[model samples]
Target: MNEQLTEQQINAAGHLTIGGCDAIELAHKYGTPLVVYDVSRIRDQIRRFKKVFEANQVDYAVSYASKAFAAIAMYQVAAAAGAHIDVVSGGELYTAIKAGFPMDRVSFHGNNKSADELAMAIHHHVGVIMLDNFHETDLLSQLLEENDAKIKVMLRITPGIAAHTNKYIQTGQVDSKFGFDLASGQADEALEKVLANPRMEMLGLHAHIGSQIFELAGFEGVADKLVEVASHWQAKYGYQARVINVGGGFGIRYVSVDHPLMPEEFVDAIIKAIKTAVAKTNLDLPAIWIEPGRSIVGPAGYNLYTVGSRKDVPGLKPYVTVDGGMGDNIRPALYQAEYETVLASNPHAPIEEHVRLAGKYCESGDILSQDQGLPATKPGDVLAMLDTGAYGYAMASNYNRNPRPAVVFAENGHDQLVIERESYADLVHLDRPYEQQ
Candidate 1:
């Protein structure tokens, strides 16, 4: 029931075509359980964020949170769009580097970054390091001093304001394990330590409230809190914050009932709050940087699955199974996430009835969605799930020995395979044979 699909998605010959390519055809070519991203949609999102900041006549940087879908192709796409890239792990950092992304535009983030990881970031001369806690501050300081390096850093602070999202995804709340807490005076301690360290250049402050945030008040609350902290620090230490990396968690429409703000509207609201806070605190406005992961790629991503088996219940809910399930997208099982499903082979057909979408996984709770209406789905019918572009692929797993599906980027009537589907051999490539031992 969610109208979350991209605008460019159309019905052609009674089949779904995303970005001018038939979705069913793409499944046949790339194989089922495929993730097809509309490249134009992604580019549009990048441009949307840029236009919003530029329109406000403010210094800003839009960094694509690559943890949503850490693919080399996506990194290249972000780079081409003139957006910075945010890598949360060594693997993501390596992927961004391998994609030939500008090292100076890459930011390394994680609460528990290892020594090797910090060294990797320092070695590559990454643009900024979003330090999450005291452990990271000490580890990174030691690593930088050891290497005789001075790098730009941002202290990830917990503004103690919780967004109205799922509690599991909330990060900026006081009880969260992510950043320096403001209420306990940990933020001030961390700021002092960073300023006293010669190897660390405190560029700004960072705070991520939560993902899938719909209310603008949460954004404004954090902005106000962070600016207040910045003002205090500026006065106490005579150190001016140059940038404020307010981490992104803007919610996207997954179901029809969910009404989230547009990119421009969201950016405008946050900027207005920052301006007000800056004026109230009598502080200089710092450059705003956002790391949007879901909003940028959520609607642009469509997941295609091949119908497999079905179980009829006569009166109770019938079960419709797909070739891929929680293995390819664990959100439904993990977060009880809901999605709108359409028959790619017959998208325009009249609705027949509602059926429960069952995953091939062995778990009983591997249901993608319950009571989803479709046009008389049958075996071999291609089912496309809307708005799966954010955490679906990033959270995919190899549970039950199911190989992960391939990913493709579609645009201008063509599709490019970005990630190859896993093979049976690949499943055990790292295993040591008992016979060998």
Candidate 2:
């Protein structure tokens, strides 16, 4: 049995279960290449993050980084757990609005936010705008003035802290394109601009080290640097920060080797770091905010696909292909991400072979897992890939003209479809003929 699947997750019939629903039955009902999320896990992760702050007697906000997996149902689930959310584009903001999410709890973030996107945020009265550069600050200032409105603004400081991840995943570096550079006084310049604009309410500072992070040292260093900047700004311009958002990169367990800290453990470490740093200065303790995306929902998501074909070569590992591939989940193809796959019917079965889990995509690099240990499987047998909730469906495309998989939410022994599977009609709905009258 793979250690990832506990005995409790295995039902009496020896079949795997997710959120109290049989994984095999879900495959039959929702069809193969389906994306399912255990709703309870999502809520529990949020509560775990919140309980840490409540126990420590500190103000905090567990903002869901929606770029990981933004959907109407996901937004509703985050809202039900009393969480704030970080929206990076107009589409995400619109999704939040459609979900009836509280506009006041939304923090808009983006590097090259257009004037139209800024106007949409203002019209919606989002909670805060994380100013990424001087152009954004000026454009936001102009938008606020034109709308005759006041909006909370936070300066996103590029703290130059390097979090351990893929080169592309590290966004907190001094040379990154995401936030204002701190070393070159770009952060200070943006702050001065925000302070000069009457319609922009300077609230606090925000910085994200990176994504899928595991070490506490990176967050600790970031916390110290954030407090140091706040103290320096206060001493120079008499400005006090009300919020300090240490953006989330808290990692989650994808494979057996990935040992992620518990949500409470991560939150506790972050809280202690901020408190220790604040104690060194005259500044009041600011509310600590974290934007958790992968940590909150990654573990809860499972991608179920049906085995379709097999390729065997002498003296080489067999290729066990599934019906779905890079089109539905591009992480593996995009960044060589790893995941654990098991037989949906019997996860505890003896491992018959360790084979290459191949996708249906035409790209040779679209392998889901280089090595997956599983029992003997035949065509039509279902396989469930674990921990694919983060950027899977959120980045789904119509590659190879394959219709994307449907999404389902299963909890308390009940299941409901969330995102309907794309149909051939839906794909061609946006097309128009040049010869049309």
Candidate 3:
């Protein structure tokens, strides 16, 4: 079976306790379909990333990708850890600011940022703005001219390397909708435009291959390509970038079959590749920056759901339904993601049979897992889906009118509520009465 739970989650007397708090007890108190995060685990991931780069004497900046798990409390954690944050939208930026995160440590990113969004980032004096395309460049230039303000920026580049991962998550390919395509000379054009403009200070270049990437070859290849591009710029325009922001996609173990490199290993491999490429091209070594979202917080989360119904098929696999489904976690439906499901009430119970874990949503595609082994599950048993800390809550929706679940932070055996469960009144809080004549 996959070790989906974090180090803080342990089985004591056949019960699961995450961060020293009993999972089953927490389920009853906080209600089923609750998300509990291990704050210590999150901090540990951050430290590991920083430690690896710092030990190599490389100037580095680690930014938390807030779109993975954006919450006020998560922002506070990143700020407390002295890490930067990557916000792709205005709402996330607002959350980071409301949480008192330093504006100098914030980075704004998006493919199609509007004029208003650019104004918001500039008004807040955000640390960096990752320019995605030509339209944004034109829009930002106009906005800066109007406001008489300057902002640091990076050009997002599509390196044309297809990562060996899901097609849905690949963002660095030449045919992607994200960054300037290098194969078509769009990247060079974008760089030229930014260099000529005086309003925006071009900090460096940024590229993100994809998410849940497991191989080191992809990282090394991306480093090589990016360095080559930088070298081209150096020779053509006598320009040297001070920073190289390679966005993160380090994969975590969601199933037993997945054997991914540790954070240290991933960092070492990428750094070594960049060093070699820079040396070959006789270029300056730029400060490295990474924006990790899932790897930092994925393993630290546990989604607790109460089993509600069981259906037995004559020959096909039996199905066990949980209170939560795609409404709270849409990864399976969207990315065809697989996760390990364990009975929180019986963590160590022997796998008596294999069954289909179905979500309570009305859609047939709401199944979380199929042919997964469980310990003869019962209706009241609490099922804990491991490794949901990344996209679980962030992608949750009110499909089928299902209210989103609450969230809690567990640390030192104490659990604190961070987000309250949505109530029925909240569902209709914006609904209008039907008494209009």
Error of 2 at 175 (Å): 0.9
- What shift in Å separates residue 5 of candidate 1 from its native position after superposition? 4.8
Residue-level lDDT of model 1, residues 274-369, one tens digit each, is: 988898875789999999999999999999999999999778988999999999999988888988898887666678888899999999999999
For candidate 3, which ten residues in a row score worst on lDDT? 1-10
Q: RMSD of candidate 1 to the true fold?
A: 1.5
Please give me the total number of clashing residue pairs in predicted model 1: 0
Give the distance in Å from residue 115's predicted Cα in candidate 3 to where it truly belongs. 1.6
Per-model C-alpha RMSD:
1.5, 1.0, 1.4
The C-alpha local distance difference test score for the whole of candidate 1 amounts to: 0.89
Task: Answer with 1 or 2, whichever has the higher TM-score.
Answer: 2
Candidate 2 lDDT (Cα, 0 to 1)? 0.92
Task: Write one digit per residue (lDDT tens) for candidate 3, span 1-437.
Answer: 33655444565556788778899999999998999998999999999999988887888899999899999999999999989999999889988888999999999999988888889999999999999999999999999999999999999999988888999999988889999998888989998999999988989999999999999988888898889989999999898988888889999989898899986688778888888899998689999888999999999998999999999879889989999999999999888899998888776678999988999999999989976888887789998898899999999999988899999999889999999999988999999989978
lDDT of each: 0.89, 0.92, 0.90
lDDT of 2 at 311: 98
